[model samples]
Target: MELVINKILNEEDFELYLKTVESFDIINPFYKLLASNIEELLNDKLRYFTLKNDDGEVLVLMPFILRKVPYLEDGQVYYDVISPYGYSGPLFNQDMSRGHLITFWKLVDEWYKANNIISEFVRFSLNHNFQFYSGVLIPTLSNVRGAILDEETQWSNLKQKVRTNYRKGASNELRADIVDGVKPEDVERFYRIYISTMKRVNADTDYFYSLDYFKNIARLSKGKILITFIYKDDTPISTELILISGNTLYSYLGGTLMDFFNLRPNDFLKVEVMKWARKRNFKYYNLGGGRVDFDSLYSYKKSFFPNDEDVIFYTGRKIIDKEVYDKLDKIMNAEVYLEKEEVMEEENDSKISFFPAYRRNAFNR
Candidate 1:
């Protein structure tokens, strides 16, 4: 087997990479639609490492974003790698022996070290593809997923509160539309509601995306992007951006107008989207976790699959070069201290807890 690292620079190469991976029955959510858009937003380089056999068939594909550390001296550049946002890690096209997997990981370590990658952080696939990860694994959060069942069974499985909200939305003349392709106006409407919702919740700056990002997603994802909008009378009240990969549907990003919260537009929108996914024979709808464990957002998503087992999200943290990692950590902490005389214990705890602790205050810098 050979390990091929692809850093696609041109559109043709990017398209070819997508085609090659789509040919396999791999469960990957880090497709180009999401990764490429994020790459542009973060100004990071994206690379894919694939293990190919003698027959030239790809056995495993791992995608990551390489971010360079700022203020480094010329020719002494250092980088860190992280899996793209959402549930993504090494995607396997077929199962392999444990020994082979071990060898693959060792080679991966060597490659990262040679490439000056100081640390690695990964959000493993929600499908439990945590094989051969010789890193610190932490249970991050719980993602709520609903298995597509027969219409009768699916409706019966929802929590009574969810059903009541749906009923209320219906009674209040809230209608939902499942749109396969996005238009400029549709993106504008979605962004207005989405940004407003983010502000309502006092979301961090990272959660706020530009309008062009959504436009790029719509343009680049081909037909794999779906937008579900909940409308009251003629005004759009809630909207969700859903992604399709393999047989699963991901509820990627969404928001609702606070004024229409009483109408329960979000609840109605989710049910309609799931119904549409079911009709298309989709197997799962992954409603991602909230900002914090068991928060209001989590409770809302949990109402969909109240009886289903908790689907925990796991993150992998690996320090490739401990010496450089420690040096950087100390430097960042010192910088923080010099800038601020008083530091909250809670903030310090959060910074230390983050993988690549040096980056915890990256935005503040």
Candidate 2:
């Protein structure tokens, strides 16, 4: 099939875009939500593009933000292009299978060389149960990235702990208002428990984005974003942010009032949302994979992912114009140009997930 690459200008065109990628999976919500977030949260504007065939088939989708590295500029400007700005390989039509994957990459590779754009990595951060990327090659990387897979078959019968917790939570009486809009104050209520949830687990809760950021996303998504509140006798106990895209309903972010353990608001709210999703004709709900390996959160997500699948991230590096990068490094940081041997030595000494410069600029830049 002959493929044509085109850029999308607005949400009005999104429905047409969906026709090309028919199988709505969990990653679909990631594409929709991230595009919404980047258009709002990013300091720079993001461009959307699609790869379609002569038969009008959209083989792959790429949505990217044009991020310029201030400290790493090469005078020749290019972007840190991540379509979706978060996870998954290029979004492809599930029906296409692996047929067009290599072709899609070839197109992408040629596009990068021609445009002088360098894509160091594409993060597959979506929470889904699908094992192995359906239509893409795992890029060359030294280490195996870790992920938690939720399989319904392995869990349909339920492990003893999963059965117990789910049963316990199932017995609790609860209700949710899964309406189209979200009040800033309602979200603020969620923030309270969200902060506590972070602290309880000692996870970093550095919320860099302003309140205005989320408000804009809710608006841009055209009511596809739903903020549900679980209430107990007029008191709100928990809240969830859910987005519908394609055939999937994604459980984005959730929090519960720390004091209302008796109400079991969180558990109640999830089941309620799952049932609501079922009524809406959504095929799958991505509750999300946990950050910690084999944690309670993983169990909770698995409880809902009946016959679910595991998703992993592959980091890609296409060193387009090495001459440009070399010169840019000399002007930027002393640490940017270390050899593989030195990098291995450094890795052996210690592991650091965040860089000092990037950490400083994460919020402001």
Candidate 3:
């Protein structure tokens, strides 16, 4: 079977591409709908890469942004290879064989070289899990799984701590309601709490999304996106933005007032979201992982699924131009690279792990 590879360039092609495959939570049609919004915000180019059969049947599609690299003379670019936020990777319609994957990468490499793409970074999906990646890049990173619930599962499956917290939240009269369609005011309120949460965590400035960004989310996700709010005495305490795509319910973004910690509002919010998902017959509710390893945040998520291992949150990076990448890396980590060959070696024995270290600080993370 011969496969033809092409880059999607127009709105007509993108809309057609959306119709070719089943929807995904992280890379769904809704996610693609918001691509233009993100491009307008970040001044990047949204491009779709596709591998299709001779009969024009699409097998794999990857939507990514071409972000211009700063400090470059010739306008070099790199593929984000996923949406600006959330999890995304290659979405497949059929089972991809090792040979098919190898061919796909060959096409991708050719396109990368043609576009002068210096490198690429990808965040793979959780629902449509793939155990391996081939060619120039492979996934060495993973996302931890907080919990996985079955349709027939009982509340008893949850950790005692989680159950206790749920009860505590109930005792405090914390109530959660899922919005049918999010409003501008609702997004603003959520953003207020979201901003506070970022500040509380000392997150990088890039985490601070603008109001227009949330507005665009509400507009693009349509009815598939719901914001669940936990309220006490009609005052919002915790809120989570959920995206229903395919058979999985993703707990996308959320925030809670730290002041309501004692009331266990966060725990109650998750319980309510899960109950909603269960009622809808959704197969999985991805609670998502923490920023790092099993820290306090992970501990909190772990309370829900005490016995489960973390889900692999896979990530990959590929460098297209080795010389350009090294030069950029050295420029970014000049303090380490600028020192004498002998003196630098002894002074800094450790090597930097940041991919294309020159663009390390470019991301909000």
Candidate 4:
């Protein structure tokens, strides 16, 4: 087996990567175009890693974002690798023996160390792809997924509250329309409601995505994205941006105007989106996890599939160079002390659970 790294610079290479992804039957929201768009916004580099057999058939594929470490003035560049924002990790084309997986990871480690990689992080897929990695794994939040194979069964399985809210929205004459394709005007409308929702909840700066970012996503991932709007008469009260992959529909980002909360637009919007996905033969509707496990957000998503089992999300963390990682951790700790005018022992302790302990502050910032 040989490991191939595709930078995906030109159209030919990009098409090749897409073909490989399809060959593996691995489909998720974070494909090349979306990842490239996000990396471009963050000024990072995207790399596609694939392990192929002697016949040039792909066995495993994974995409990573190479982010340069901050505050490193040692005249040498160091980088940390992370999976794309959403659910993604190493995807195997087919079940392999233990020996094959061992060999694959060995090659992966060699490549990371050969490059100037300091650390690696991965967010495993929620669809239960066979993942093999020699790293510390943590069971993160649980995402609520509703199976929508049969429309009748899905509606029958909905929680009473969700059913009631959807009915309420219908009674209020709130209508939902799934945009045929992402349009500039629809993106603007979605951004307006999304920003208002973020501000109402006091979301972090990182979550306040730029309008240009949304526009770029629509442009780059044209066919893979779906935009749905909930309208009251002539005004849109709620909107959701969904990502499509294989047979699943992921509720990527969405928001509801607080003033229209009484209309139950969100609940009604979700039901309509599921129906739309079901008609398209999608199997699952992944309502991602909340800010914290079992929080109000999680509870709200759970209302859709009250009896469905929780799909646990797992994250993998690994430190390639321990010595360099320790040095950076100390530097960041001192910087934090200087900024806060006190030793943040508690904060540091809390951050120990976070991987690459050095960049804990960066994430918070």
**Candidate 1 error regions (>4 Å):** 38-44, 71-75, 96-99, 337-352, 363-365
> What is the C-alpha local distance difference test score of candidate 4?
0.79
- Candidate 4: worst-modelled 10 consecutive residues by lDDT: 343-352
Q: Model 4 off-target regions past 4 Å?
A: 8-16, 36-44, 71-74, 95-99, 149-156, 337-352, 363-365
How much is the lDDT of residue 177 in candidate 1? 84
Query: How much lDDT does each candidate structure score?
Result: 0.79, 0.53, 0.65, 0.79
Clashing pairs in 4: none
Report the lDDT tens digits of candidate 4 across residue range 199-302.
Answer: 99999887888888788777766478889999999999999998887787888898998899999998999999888887877888888888878889999999
Worst 10 residues of 1 by lDDT: 343-352
TM-score of 4: 0.86
Q: In candidate 4, how many Å is residue 149 off?
A: 6.3
Residue lDDT tens for model 3, 31-122: 44544365443453666667776776566666666666665556644432333356666776444565666666678777787767777776
Per-residue lDDT tens digits for candidate 2, residues 219-274, read 65656777888876677777877776656666676677777776566656766666
Better of 1 and 2 by TM-score: 1
Better of 2 and 3 by lDDT: 3
Off by over 4 Å in 3: 1-30, 33-42, 72-83, 95-99, 127-132, 135-153, 335-352, 361-365
Total clashing pairs in model 3: 5
Question: How does each model score on TM-score?
Answer: 0.88, 0.64, 0.80, 0.86
Evaluate model 1: give its lDDT: 0.79
Ranking by lDDT: 1, 4, 3, 2
